[model samples]
Target: MNLLPAYVLLDLETTGATPARDRITEIALIRYENGEEVARWQTLVNPHMPIPPFIQTLTGIGDDMVQAAPDFESVAPRLYQYLDGAVLVAHNVRFDHGFLKHEFQRIGIILRQKVLCSVKLSRLLYPQHRSHGLDAVIQRHQIVVAARHRAMGDVEAVAAFIEAAGRELGEDRVALEVARLMTAPSLPPGLDPSLLDELPETAGVYLFFGADDAPLYIGKGVNLRSRVLAHFSGKTTDMAQAVRRVEWLETVGEFSALLLESHLIKTRQPLHNSLQRRQRQLCAWRLAAAPDIHPQAQLVREDAIDPTALGDLFGLYRSRKHAEEALRGIARNHALNPRLLGLESGDVRASSEPDAQHYLRLKLALAAQRLKDWPYPGKIAVREYDATSQRTQLHVFEHWCYLASVDNEADLHDVLAQRSTPVFDLDIYKLLQQVLLPPAKTGAKPAIGGLEIVHFQDGYDQQKTSSSSQ
Candidate 1:
């Protein structure tokens, strides 16, 4: 039996991994019909951009080689003819398909075809093998190639692997696997499949909208495409089916995605986002100042939160009742007086300790929840950069509040000039703590991994001073 009636074994060598930002430098494919090779095509297309040195080193196709070659637009029609009405076969087929769809889109041609992944085929055929990468398959099956990393070379390797699979694991079984792998992922009837192709595999926030442009859900992911596609995989859900439109905003990194996700969820109040909705009555415990004779703790509401006194704040609770419940739990566990904590009306004799000792014990119990003081003397901008897209985002923060994310110096200046008192957010505070706080054992300074920290002096006139990573 023929493994596939018609299929094209394809591969692409691109400038980088991201299809939305990077350009394809080369394309190669071999069309097969009835288990026989009918046509072979390969070309070096000018990407209209400089191929990075590392990519050139890997693919052995440099600027000079593609200088005279036709650009993707020039080769679009012929390439489409070769690809149309055939199952696109490749190792890690999504990577190749994503690039093809994007390139075709640039020329106003929507390229959509059934796909079969040889890597998945290898995994399904040889379940014991841990690695199904092309290199691993080539070495395991002893398939020789005229070249490697180059587009044509990788295509040949994948084609050889499929042919060998037909021989080793009966043609019937190979064909069965091909049929199973060709089954496309289901998409909502109202949603467009092309939208999934447009999603970049980068850090970003995505919003799903239902009928009448009502928001169904809002979420963030490092790979927006993979995460969004996962919703349609396996068992379908009501939210996935209700989704009629999809929108996304790409970010420089995961931190920015997170901040945006939190902000959007609270503001938009999507139908499916139950947990991240705005906590209007959010409250926290503010410890009393030293030598004060007032209550040891006071419940402060969200609007009343003082950014300057964030260091004196404790656990962020959902409401007044939650705050009281938490303090009661701390008082019971630490054997402190409830009257001293302002939790009850009458004095209860939990312990005969002095007021200062009781306060000390309460403070000790709440130490883990106590907010950290802002390490910087002034506002600081956490700079996140993406090398692939050449994008930069400066996330400005005061205390634990996220002020704004700016891309240009002029915008940054504007943000500084229009500085207002930053409001403390529970979600932003938690995110910043997780990213900026150092480990307890190390006793090191707070630092964001792989990000630059810049300090602003006093006003818009103050120049940005870069500090060592902290």
Candidate 2:
């Protein structure tokens, strides 16, 4: 066997520096086998979390742009396999490599592989030069810089430097150096010695497949290659029993990765993802009467909660039973009569009844905590992100009830144009009530402003049936 290992050039664009908290935005990888081109992959993944303004400006990747990209969990397997038997190449190798290892470790994967830092190679080969950064290398070697800090451009720069090194140093010398660079890093015995230094640090998801190709866990990171390796830093005692194969996905942005993850957990229902896939039931406390009218408590589903008009609504609940319990607690706290509050069905006491004073006292006391009236004139939606799946999900609300979620602009338009009345969901009601409610001291404001109300056809109802797979 030649034992001349294949090489992979990798690069990543992330939401921030910290792998544990921040997310990957973009990635690029180029595979070389025995000094010949083998394959290339790249993508933009939505981080599902907001990218700080400074990062947005630096990477030129932002929320509005990656709103539709697939999430990290969806793409982990393929990328992992690509790096399984290669030597990883990068400019500032440690930063890129360190980030990858951290992300993979979070999802419970251990990676071990030989890694080559071009910055180190540049320094080793050209001791006369002072700087070994990507910019310095590109400038010194006259390599064209396209896309700059973006994943693909950075990866291309590494490839360019490799070619330059090969040409200047002679094939024999370059081959020997690359061989020396291919020495595997120290890692846990069970982990593939071929893995750590090989993964591409790009926007996507990664999967840790245990013995017999069973998927042990899934994860997402901007730099897939580095994140994979960090798993073997000798800290993961939990993954000892089951890790074997490595897999990954190169995505376009973090939003796509998040949405994909949520969908995959539901679709694959992977053994390790069971806890994450369980959907929490959502409920809201709705006043039996409409806003602008006297408030009375009623339990409604979250999908029934209206976004634009949440007045007369209070408390989000995990279940209708929970909502009722909360209402009862509030009533007891304020001395409100359970009967007068409609906790039970019965006739109101006559004004002249001897016990009427007690009811009046109770009602007056409860009135202080009674739900408020809707502040807006119409309906709207609150937006949330699924970072792992990389999608922007719109939770619609109308008159203190959550109607449904829209995945795309077309779906948004369809939901807005639909004329059919949305079904009431108690869970959605609670969700809206809690989200829209102002703080005790500061009060709540519109999550987003000036939502247009128009006649709708409910196209989203049908679109939701299939677009969810994407």
Tens-digit per-residue lDDT, 257-361, candidate 1: 888999999889999998888879899998777624557898889999888887788988988999899999988988877888888777535546777777787
In model 2, the Cα lDDT at residue 429 comes to: 42
TM-score on alpha carbons, each prediction: 0.82, 0.40
Best by TM-score: 1
Q: Write the per-residue lDDT of candidate 2 for residues 235-275, one digit (tens) a residue.
A: 65466346767777755444334434554555555557655
Clashes counted in candidate 1 amount to 0
Please identify model 1 stretches exceeding 4 Å from their true place.
15-22, 119-141, 164-177, 193-202, 290-292, 347-353, 376-394, 406-420, 439-470
What is the lDDT for 93 in model 2? 66
The CA lDDT at 257 in model 1 is: 89
Error of 2 at 290 (Å): 6.1
lDDT of 1 at 98: 84
Top candidate when judged by lDDT against the true structure: 1
